[model samples]
Target: MRNRTLILGVTALAVAVTGLAAPSFAARDKMTPEQRAERMIKRLDTNSDSKVSLDELQAHMTANFKAFDTNGDGQISADEMQAKRQAFRDARKAWQEAKSKDGKERDAALAQLKDARPAMVPGMRPKAFKRVDADGNGSLSAAEVASASEKMFKRRDKNGDGVIDAADFTKKI
Candidate 1:
């Protein structure tokens, strides 16, 4: 009996050590341009349509804004992000209670809410025009325009390139 207990304790300690050494699931993975484009396409094609029309992209963006823009303002402030998180939690609880929905409807509703926020105000960081002009030719192509977006509530991308995925805003740092 003592031998079995010792073995169990050793196994538990090994498992605990393994868990501590395990890599985080959220760590970033390098993606090829094609892979990045595919992810962008997947996100934009919310309706599962093989192709995303301009209007569909706009609609999807609007919904996203509503979820993150808690203040109902055009931009996502820090406070607004907290509020949105709480609201999401509440909605999730309600959704769990219903159990009839797979949360698809809840997600759709949240997306629609964000879409209702005003078109991003002027002078927004990571300016939309900047993002679209990826080659600095001062022209935005349909594909280029599709991927430009805001990260957090501040950093904005004018071009949808995956190169600027880092969140660091400071140039020198």
Candidate 2:
């Protein structure tokens, strides 16, 4: 029971520990690219320098890995990954049901689920996981997570500035 609570807390923190006041889940859908960048920066920028360094990004990604590696196994299994997915599916189901109700009830449900925030791990698809799991061992380790995060940080640092800022998130339409 305690482990579950700890996992939930860490999972929440890893996904979106927005230091600033974050937008509603509904508003998040409407957020512009620049806005999304700023929100991500607020969550990932540990030093509060308005940007995300590779170290900061890897730290957050490692935290996510820890959360996914429930049971303190130091590696993530298919079961653990599916469990996170199931939680989001359950929340999403409830949210859809609540959508048929009156405005207040729908809004209340949205608040509780926050658009099924549990599965917000970036690019959580099987292909992405395989790419990260360099050993092909069918489980993910902390080292794989570190390597993947470094790659992710470099990919997002579009301007080659060594850190990710609003510019990375923004795109010219």
Candidate 3:
């Protein structure tokens, strides 16, 4: 009875440790380029039609155009793109200021933010902004975006199968 009790306790502890080391259930998780494309195509085909109609395509495109046309001119120019980026900076500054205005010296907070820069630069644009901006909208949206996400998974898959295996995420971004 004593030996059986010790084994059960060890097993329970091991199970608990394994659970703690695993990823949480709520993670949206990163997807490969091919997965991204396949998902986009699925989303675009909302009605399950084999092909996406011009109207559906147009709706998606128009929504994307509106996002990059910051000046409401129905076109996205370089200047407008710059303005949008500046706006994001301003918003971040304002949010940080508001959160830390309790008479705290912000040097440490600012330094921490600076350390987070390298990762953020890539997020500002999806690939080369100009190349992916198929319609020259200066930004990307579902319509302007390409389906290369699934390709990312394919490159990591190694087996060429459509599905990504659990161990393939070791080198994921």
Report the number of the highest-lDDT candidate: 2
Please provide, for model 1 over 39-152, each residue's C-alpha lDDT reduced to its tens digit, 9 standing for 90 to 100.
666666656754444555556656665554445545454344445455656665665555565578767655654544334322223354454446665433333333453332
User: TM-scores of all models?
Assistant: 0.31, 0.69, 0.37
Query: What's the lDDT for residue 148 in model 3?
Result: 27
Off by over 4 Å in 1: 1-28, 74-173
Of the two candidates 1 and 2, the one with more favorable TM-score, higher being better, is 2
Best by TM-score: 2
List model 3 lDDT by residue over 32-54, tens digit each.
Answer: 66566556556555467433444
Question: Candidate 2, residues 1-173: lDDT per residue as tens digits?
Answer: 99999999998887775633365555756977677778788988899889889888877887788778778989887677878778778877889899989999889788868744652344377788777788999888888778777877888898899999877766641
lDDT of each: 0.50, 0.78, 0.52
A best-first ranking of the candidates according to their lDDT comes to 2, 3, 1
What C-alpha RMSD separates each model from the true structure? 11.3, 17.9, 11.2
